[model samples]
Every structure is written in structure tokens, then in C-alpha cells.
Target chain A: MIEQDWIWGLVGGLMIGSAAALYLLVNGRIMGASGIIGGLVDRSGWEGGTERAAFLAGLVLVPMLVVPLYETVETHITSNLAVVIVAGLLVGVGTRLANGCTSGHGVCGISRLSLRGIVATVFYLLGGALVMALARHVLGVI
Target chain B: MLRLLSALVAGGLFGAGLLVSGMVDTTKVQGWLDVFGDWNPTLAFVLGGAIVPMAIAWRVAERRKVAVLGGPLPLMTEGEARPGRNLIIGSTVFGAGWALAGLCPGPALASLTFGGTGGIVFVVAMAAGMLAAPPIRARLDRMQPA
Candidate 1:
């Protein structure tokens, strides 16, 4: 049985909020993680230098900051690097193909009540659930 | 300055929510899916907890006639149903992949805050997907009507 910690939820919310703030404050972009991470690959899309670097850096560095505070953090991921690399690549391609990443369509777009965003998000959730089922249950890949 | 501050507020709140919900962990997600094995209910609680904020936010935003995030407030637009054949096929493909990855963009970033090799890989691949999609879209768009 998996345990749910309310603290983690709160932390997640703040990170998402701070990231969103940083993105908009300096770059005028939404903190849609997909877009930010995606921008790393397509840097030309972003105009500002200090802001983009800082924003992207925050994504990478903020977690490192947590290490000192939390000391050691552990996670459950059984997939090898090769699997992750391929998955990440597929998601990058998917976001561009679908016209928005999960954060853009799922968080901001759906929150905005955009029809396109809603449709995209529904598909995303369903996709996520299906993926989990297939990987863990069907394939027995931990 | 005000715009930036407000943006910060919104994002901070969003990050906090991810932590509180335990969504930062794919194991939690996998637990939810492996109902026969572990039968995790945290996902249900998250779905439930989300309702509270959603209601409050909806009501407040409706009353204010403004989005707390600032910008032109968005209203729902119900367009004439034009569900294309491609939409169905595309959704099928997307759902399949998401089920496999468990690390969608939002959590992947938050997971990065925790700093792990898998999380890093999850994010890197997600970025690649985002980059490759556009050209594919352009190609398809060229074949279809605007």
C-alpha cells in the first residue's frame, strides 16, 4: 500500500507555484515544465538570457538545494537509463505533436477552461494511467 | 513588479500542491495502477482533495470576474462538435504512452527537485518529445485544410 503525505502535496504545490512565478516574472512564459524543459532543447524560442538560464537553472538546481535540507532523498524507479531516455524523447515529440505539454494543457490550459486544453489533458491523464498499467502490471516491469 | 509577484504566488502555490499530493512519486502512481497488488488509495484522496480547491477557486474567480493569476479571464467555449477521426486515434496513442511513462511533465519537474537519475531522464526525454512534435505537426497541417 502506498502512503500519501499531505506535506509532499504542499511542497509540490509551492514548487509548481514558484516555478510558475519565476517563468512569468522574468520571461513572460508560463511555468509549464514541459515548455521550460522543452525550451532547453529549443533555446532559440526564448529571448531573454539571464531569465531563461535562471529559470532553467532553478529547475535543475532547486532539487540540489533540497539535498542539503532533506539530506538524502530516495525514489522508486526500476527502469534503466535507456528506457527513461526513450520515454523522455517520446514525450518531447508528443508535446510538440499535441501542441502543448501536460503543464500547459493540463494545468494552465484546463484551468483556463480552454476546450482544446481540456481535450488534451483528458487524453494525457488517460495516457498516463494506461502507461502505468501496462508497465507495472502487464509487463511486470518495476 | 506586481505582475511578477503575482506570478510567483501562483507558482509557489502550484509547487506546494504537487508535494502535498504525493504525485512527485511514480511509485505512488504505480501503486494506484497495481490495484490487485497494493491497491493504493492515495490517488483517490488526491482526486477528492482537489475538489475542495477547485470549488473555492471556481467560485472566487466567478465572483471576482478576474483570474487570480492575472490576464484576460478565460471562459468556456462550447464549439460545435467537430471531433475528428484523428483526434480519437491520437488520444489512443497518447494514453498508451502515458501509461508507460508515469512521469508526465509536471511531476517530472517536481521529481527533479528531489534529484534522481530517473527523474532527470524522464524530464530529458519529455523535452525531446516536445521538440520533435512541431515538425510532425507542420507536416500534417500541410496535408490538411487550415
Candidate 2:
């Protein structure tokens, strides 16, 4: 896709990993994006609300500041209105039900070799691949 | 103070990484998932690279009870670490959504500053889902008892 995408991907990956490491080592918390946000949504995270709020503020704010620096950032996300809504709903429910998302399970969970994390990662990847094949190749909806 | 600061810094760095790694690009994410079609292997590098430092951090964390800033580490007990039905079902469902939109929670939030109306819609829906999950989960647990 983009030129040298792999290089940028690698560099970005290191930054993410370093962030996770810093969160773990310094804060003593798993840097799971879903858990942080979901906790607030369900009101289960009220006890530690300030920290979660602060984290989310940065999560949202940093991109605002940094994205302007780039010439362009193309997401290529689906434009179909219904698809967007449905996908969003599913992502929310699935991640909450599973008790983690890509960050919590994929990066943080798997890093610690937790069975729950590993299993979730495998299943999600499988689910994603199956849906991709069906929707893109067969149905041609998204 | 330290806790909040660390979270802020960590969150900032994580957001930047998502942007830099091109994880915010739905096409790149979709291309990686499109294994049978024209495959893009860039995401693999992102995953592999992220795992390296995190794996090391886990090891380093294992030897310590408290974090460097004096907080309780996320110590997973045997029960907490085990996989269950919800984990399987939820992950699969999440995957379907990810495939549909080519964005996950991290990328969804990271892209919000520049993601336009679609990003806003997705985040809102995702938040709704999160709000509804507890009751649904409670019912499911009642029915399944597991």
C-alpha cells in the first residue's frame, strides 16, 4: 500500500511496545485500550476514574496534535453508513464480552503468555480473516 | 500524580505508535487480514515488533511485586489467566467487526482527531455496545452457568 509501510509499521510497533512496557513497569497496569475505556462505559472503573480519564485524554489528544504533522493519513475505513454502525457495535460488544481487545489481549495479554489472551487473539484473527474473505471476496459488501 | 503522569505519557506514546505504524489505516489492516487475496505483510512486522519489548517487560515484571512507581502490577492468578467461553465468542465477534471496519479500539480512538464522521459513528456505536455488554453478559452467564 503506502511506500515502505513495513518500515513505518516496525517503527510504530516499537513505540507501542515501549509504551506498553512503560505502562507496565511504571504504572503497574496493563495498557489495554478497551479495558480502560470500557471500564468507564460500564462505570466499573469509577474507583480509578481519574487515571482512566487521563489516559483516554492523551489517547485522543496526542493524535490530534501529531496527525497534523503528517502530510496525509489515509484510513480507508468503510464508508457505508450501516457497515460503520454495525461494525462499531460488534467491536464494542465483542471486546467487552471478551474482557479485552487488541491492545489488552493481542499485545499485552499475549506478551505475558496468558492463555486467555492467546486464545482470544487466535479466535479474533480467525474471525477477522473469515469475515474478510466472506465480505470482501464473496459478498463484495465492504 | 506519578500514576496519572505515567498513564498520560503511555497513552500519548501508544497513540503515536498507532499513527506511525500505519495501524490507523483501515486498508492496511484489511489488506493484512485479506490473506487469500492481495496480502500485505506489514501488520505482521508491527505485531512482531510490539511483542518484543512487551515480552521483555513481562519477564521484568515477573521478578517484581510492585511497579517502579509503587503500584500493584496486574498479577494474573490461575483463574484469571484461563480461557473461557466468553473469551472465544467475544473475540470472534470482535474480529467480525474489525474486518468490517478495519479498525479496533486503539485505532478507532487514535484516528478520532482526523477520522471524520465515520470515526465518530464507529466510536459511538462501540461505546454503546460496551455499555450494553454487562447486562447481556449477565444473562448469558445465567443461561450457560460457566
Largest lDDT belongs to which candidate?
A: 2
Residue A39, candidate 1: Cα error in Å is 4.3
For model 2, the stretches where C-alpha displacement exceeds 4 angstroms are: A1-3, B75-81
List candidate 1 stretches off by more than 4 Å. A1-31, A47-61, A71-73, B1-13, B33-37, B44-97, B142-146
Candidate 2's residue-wise lDDT over B25-68, tens digit each? 99989998999998899888888889889999888887786899
lDDT string, candidate 1, B20-84, tens digits: 56665666755655545765656555544443343334334445544444543323332423434
Error of 1 at A71 (Å): 6.1
Q: Could you give candidate 1's per-residue lDDT for residues A10-115 as a string of tens digits?
A: 4454444444433433334545655555665677456543443454454444444554565334446545777677666666666655656555655555444556
Residue A49 of model 2 has an lDDT of 90
True contacts kept of 1: 0.37
lDDT, candidate 2, A1-142, per-residue tens: 4558989999999999999999888988888999999999889998989888888888889999988887777777777979999999999999999999989998988777888899999999999999999999999998
Local distance difference test scores for all models: 0.54, 0.89
Q: Counting only residues 3 or more apart in sequence or on different chains, how many pairs clash (N, Cα, C under 3 Å) in candidate 1?
A: 48
Docking class of 2: high
